[model samples]
Target: MLPALVERYDYDPYGATYIAYRVPSTYDDASQTRDPNLLTDPAAWQPCESSRFGNPLLWTAQRYDPAVRLYHFLFRTYSPTLGRWMQRDPAGYVDGVSLYTYVASSPTCHVDPLGLTYIISPYQIEALIAELRRRPDIGGGLRGRTRTPSDQKAPTNGCSSPFGDAPSGVNFRGACDEHDRCYQTLGKSRFECDNEFYADMAHLCLAYASSEWQLAECLRWAMVYYIAVRVFGGWADLYDFLKWNGHARRNVSPLEPSRPAPRSQPPYTQPPYTGLGAGTPWCPSRRSPYGD
Candidate 1:
């Protein structure tokens, strides 16, 4: 029985493939029997100049035409021999001034699969990741990769309180309700939603307070809530995505916050000079508002 020969392939940094195979002459005719033991030996295997596979392709994504020795990309043709694209980029000078550059001329580090844009993974969402890792019970089952952040759904209860369930504690459920809606709304960022949540809590803490001490305590509790959410909040998964194509969208326009113009002061009117009159000075005792 003859041992099956498997072709071995080697690749260079620039998507070039080298193959090792056997000569056809050894098994050319029925009477010409080759040594099976030779096939198993490493010395028997040699580099093949010609490829048996009709379609030769490149690694950073390309369809190779063996006849022309050129790779057919989506928007450009690449010549592995020249180590550059044969045509200009279809997206014009968006990437850079050089139109024929491939992966910014760095094949080993980057890959331009579609011949349009170079892809690089940016590790972001630190807050979200930290929260997921810190609180396993809450974020354990929520780490879903099947859906994007834009597909997040609002909770049926509106505000599933992350704060203490004790009835006497601050009613942060109202803030959470607003936050949940803000998250579900389109074009709202996670940062924006979280900011609004903090604002709502602040309003609640200050609005109904009767005394200065009460106000201070309420603000303290509000700050605690804000800090908790700020540190251990849910990941960016609970918000709408600003851009999709796997790249973070950059806003080209300036984002000047909306602020009303300053109110103009009226001209001061000088009162007529009044005559001074002498009188005995009287003093009143100051009263303590705190009943001290």
Candidate 2:
């Protein structure tokens, strides 16, 4: 995920945004042909402004909080299918999210209720790999330019080139064809991903929202579970637990450990959280989308 950067201009009065999956080469070129105008140009080969978020030409402010930017970038680009599913079935996802938040904020954190453990089975790992192979849209490109979800593969270890002659052992276990079918068949549906693995994923997300404990532990747990699930077989017990409990797992409060998440921070942000650095006031530009 790209960190948001502010660019200045002397000629053209207004500047633009640049949202890219991969940083452009110009940014690294010795000659530095990385002109903001060219990079953000609507006519550029990699038209970034076309994303669901407003056009770079017209949009003037980053919509996300600075701290959450990394969170959004990772989750958004890495788990588009999961993100979409969350949007489609928010009630279901919210149940898990809420439980995670409660655990994070609770005092006397003796045991991390949200810190889930799992042992990935080989079958699950193969299934995940198959899903990757199925996604040509994310993988098919020249040499080593392809990108996959952070959880799916690592580029440095050489998993980027899905079609290379000397394919890396880090290569996706399954093919893109299978990934497509699996994704399509399960789009926004309550299908089980390795259930044993989810306790860990849920914890990581909750960690992102908290500052109370050792989030690093949560991250480590997430990675371990991810590798296990993607490299080994899937976990059937976790899947059964999620299913048996139904799609929504209600969180119980101190008094009622069964009640739904006690309306924590409301789903929506109260005010737009434009990330202007502290001490410096945010002076909205008249022409900017976030007008004063």
Query: Judged by TM-score, which candidate is best?
Result: 1
lDDT of 1 by residue, 111-204 (tens): 5655654432112122323332354233112233111122235652434433331112235565655566555666544434444455444444
**Candidate 2 TM-score versus the reference:** 0.18
C-alpha local distance difference test of each model: 0.45, 0.26
Worst 10 residues of 2 by lDDT: 276-285
Question: Candidate 2: misplaced stretches above 4 Å?
Answer: 1-34, 37-191, 204-213, 234-292
- For model 2, residues 1-292, the per-residue Cα lDDT tens digits are 4443323222111112334433443343222554555445433234233344433222212132322221121112111112211122212232234322311121121111122321223343334334333542222221232222222322222112213211111112222222222223322211122221232232223323233232333333344334333322233433444345432244321111111212452232112111111110111111111110
After the best TM-score superposition of candidate 2, give how far the Cα of residue 247 lies from its true spot, in angstroms. 40
